[model samples]
Target: MLVIGIGFFYLRPIIPFLQSQRAEATTVNKVKAIETLQNSDEFSKKLAAAALKRTAEDVEYDPGYYDIAYPGGDLPANKGVSTDLIVRSYRALGVDLQQLVHEDMSEHFRLYPQLWERKGPDRNIDHRRVPNLQRYFSRFGKVLNNSHSLDDYDIGDVVTWSLPYGAAEQAGSHIGIIVPGPGARSGEKWVVHNIGSGPKWEDKLFDYEIAGHFRFGPIRESMTAAADTKSGATLSN
Candidate 1:
């Protein structure tokens, strides 16, 4: 009788906590589309839009890894400064992306790989092998899947991926964010991810590259103060 009573006492408090966590996982709330961009301090919004534009919509399949090219005829930076682009954009947004600490972006992935266990129709990533994926997922709220639904995902929305890396492209590694466009059919939802690199969201995941995707919406301007991100030399988004 004592053992049973003790077990009940120990678990009583935990049941409520576990229930709360589950509740948090299932909830889905997406931010508005262009409104998110327009409100996200012009610079951050411009950078988010630019990262998507900088993707493959360019000169046509150059067939090279890390091919250096600028978007919309914009001149390319001397070095591939992807991180710089993100931070500068944050500065423009009146927030510092660098200020986002690990805690700010770490605990979002509660269940981690479990979110997208199998290689669903996407055929992109394993969802588990993605870099720092657990951190991002656990730190943020419930992640959004790839399927399009304007009310479900929006601009400045962040996504993470467990990508396939290494020479033969057989290895698994990579993580990034997603930027949404007008509508689901508007065809402008792009990604802001990094595979074996710093914080820069890429436009597309081509070749045999497959990684986890986290549909993280941009929070209010005041949230950046919680981000304890690391600083680095100037880089491009």
Candidate 2:
């Protein structure tokens, strides 16, 4: 004769373990997320999806007027807007942006290496201060300098500026865009980023040594290692 025994599980007992497992799973996901980001094309759709999810992690726009603490008690505001969420979200998906940030620091002209270190609306991180960083940041604010509209943009794009001469010290040009590339404009693709206002943005840029431009994709072959770390499947032979 053969017999079999059945067992039942109580969620409470397994809940803690399940949560722990979920956290681990998220960590793994983040690892994968970072690799994906490091290797994919600048305008890759996959990267966009990963960044969007990351942006949603923080409930508040910490940099904005919204002021409410995140439920987890780690971040400051509830629904604030900070690139940290984008980075953390990548963590949830098993990714860490730091890997790329540290490896290819030169690729980014106006990199804010310590943007994550500061808090409480403090933008005093002395990043590599590119010549025209401010002009770039101004494009996304409530008052974009020459913007018509920002209806099409993603994440991981860059923007440059051409500030007035002589004032380059205090009122010089600036550029930055940890966001994404915008849609096609005048038959050419545009980029999206926050110069000072809403995240819902889009704009036009040129491919040159001057005003502004958007860039997304791997800069160095060494950094591409992140793509293979996933070990699940390879893409783009």
Candidate 3:
């Protein structure tokens, strides 16, 4: 009877211990799965999309060139221009274009255009400029050929265009990020930009002459993966 009692006591503890171990194992697996998904390219696209959506929520459209601080500085969230869309989208992915562009411009100031006519790199406005971002991405990112084919660009890709303003043919640069999902127009991809109005997702991929096309970070790899997926499906079929 004593042996039976001891066995029962030990077995009861073992059952709870095994249950705890199984729960711990399940938790570890769940965490691992979450980490894997977070590291995927889809996560980056989702981050950019969320950023664009948030930007679109701000109805105020202020284009004033405010003198701001450096590094992590920013104007009022609601008050910004086209480049702010790019800055905030990439910022959502934890890729601070403001700091990245400022650092790059500081190292190679001469490489960037002198549109603002500033002597050196200004962190406050350098990243906020479309041309500076174009040059920065061209240098650091995979600069895709500016083509009319929509297949060339993918979600998370950055595109620039020239906007002529005023007389004397003074052209201004505009930038935007491509996002997935339904576009404003059927059979067209959506773009998040602040063109005069606040940030919005529109089917303006070819609205202006594409001055630059770039795949920054892991966007290119994601495009390749998507392409591979399509190819694999075709082969299987």
Candidate 4:
């Protein structure tokens, strides 16, 4: 009885320490799991790099309607919106989101939101809308859980947020692509978006209500074929 009491008294102080160690281990395991599920594959790395490259461009925040070419269409390089940033990034990977979204909406018109009350798909402006892009990603890409936890996000992941009503020109919804955090925030992840000024890499991942999170890698077979064609080579069976 005396020995038991002595051991209990001596071990009491370290109990909290042991509990903290267990908690830390649990956190590490969770981080590992997130990393595994959202593993930074070659496609993701290239996409993230493409997104990072947008930070160097001088683009104006413009959402005006323009009749651009079909398939490989794009607005002027100097003008774009948030979705434009995403579109341009994917284009860098030889994936034309404008054409993909337009084609998908044409086939699955009912699957998209009718907020705009459009009679049919408008390829010119459909892919540039945040809701359309959200639906497209949900349908074709991997939709991830939305949470305030920073660990839930990773490079190349796409995040959508609900802005306050009448907040700014981008009042309804906003989207951004996750990129590696900048200098001081090196350990954290940042988002590349054009809120108003232009394409920017900022630490605003959890600034608003997270609506959707997505990870989209280009279709491998198509991307490979596109690359081979660009390099003046043909794929062999």
Candidate 5:
């Protein structure tokens, strides 16, 4: 009886410590798994670079409200905003942001902001708005930190920043895609955006207060299988 009591007393004190160690181990394993998934396929990265490179030719910045078609609809090739750079880049990779955003907002309208007081999803401009895109990315894509670390921002990663001025009650938001730089800046990444001037590559990534960071590809289950084939592991959505 003494032996049994002593053994129970010793084990009882260490049970919580063992549990804590197990929890730590589990977390470490999960992080490693996600790390494996984070290294995306090279094709997507190359496609994003190629698409951003094409924008430098003549992408004029224009933020006018236009009534366009749904699904594959877009502004004129010459005119676009910061979000257009992202939309066009993804479109170059066969991922239609317009259709994807519309479909997601349609199903989860309540999840998106009702800033315009609109009752339903507006396909004409919902996909073009920065806030909407940010929310969509948060819901489906891998949400990243707003850290100063360059390693966190990868080629093909989507980043959002807040502008000083804004329309309506909300602060203005801008979005861009990470791409390669030139000359000395080549080692560090640059951003492709249409911040008033037009679609251009600049090393102004940390210029504004970063609002959101994301990796948005294959967010849905159907897309995950195809993504896994190239990435060699399942990515976190």
Candidate 6:
């Protein structure tokens, strides 16, 4: 009885530590299981690759309005907000979200949020707004359930979050793209976003209140073909 009591006393101190380690291992295993289940489709892979490339560029967190050209407009490469990351990524895939959003809003102006209170759609800045992008994705992309489960988010998925109440209106919302994690987080996923800083790939998937989740990838060949036909230029493969 004395020997057993001594052993229990020594083990009690490390019991919590062992439990935590076990829990962490379980989580990692779950992440790996979900990773294996990921579709790994060509479009998603391309989108993830494109977003990952953004991490290499030095972008300033600038949200100033500028009158860029239509059809394939973009803010200066060095300055952009979170939405710009999404814009640039999809643009890499030959998907002109600016044009698509502008055209859709033009015909269905009432369908979108009038938060900015503009008379009509402003192609110059509409696509750069988070709310506008959320609406666009919900309309055209597959809207996934917003949950705390890491399993729900997959590579190339787009996520949006509502910032805390005191944040500036322009900074009230944020967005990011999911991509494969780096190094130790390989079993998990990371988010690529430009929140106040330049583009980054970090393990911040659940850092904020998830407001929207979407899978908008695997661009249909017809869509790419139509874009090519309209622009009179072949999209990058």
Candidate 2 C-alpha lDDT tens digits along 81-140? 334333333333333333444333434434432333442222221212342233223322
Candidates in order, TM-scores: namely: 0.38, 0.31, 0.68, 0.75, 0.71, 0.75
Residues 1-237, model 4: lDDT tens digits: 999999999999999887665433233433342344245567776677777777778998887787776766777788888999998888877888877888889999989998787989987889889999999999889999998888888778999988898653446689988876543334677777888899876778888888999998776444222321121111122
Candidate 1, 39-143: lDDT as tens digits: 666443554654443332222211112321111111133222333333333444444433332233334334333444432311112221333333444455455
When 2 and 6 are scored with lDDT, the better candidate is 6
Output the number of the TM-score-best candidate: 6
* Reference-based TM-score, model 6: 0.75
lDDT string, candidate 5, 29-79, tens digits: 333322432455664475455445555458766776666655556677776
Candidate that beats the other on TM-score, 4 or 6, i.e. the better one: 6
Clashing pairs for predicted structure model 6, backbone only: none
Q: List the candidate numbers ranked by TM-score, top first.
A: 6, 4, 5, 3, 1, 2
Worst 10 residues of 3 by lDDT: 228-237
Better of 4 and 5 by lDDT: 4
Model 5: weakest 10-residue lDDT segment is 226-235
Q: Which ranges in model 4 have alpha carbons more than 4 Å from their true place? A: 1-41, 168-170, 220-237
lDDT of 3 at 58: 68
Q: Give me the overall lDDT of model 1.
A: 0.38
Best by lDDT: 6
Q: What is the lDDT ranking, best to worst? A: 6, 4, 5, 3, 1, 2
What clash pairs does model 3 have?
A: none
Q: Please give the lDDT score at residue 56 for candidate 3.
A: 33
- State each model's CA lDDT, in order: 0.38, 0.36, 0.64, 0.76, 0.69, 0.77
Candidate 6 structure quality by residue, lDDT tens digits, 41-80: 5677667777777777899887777777777777767878
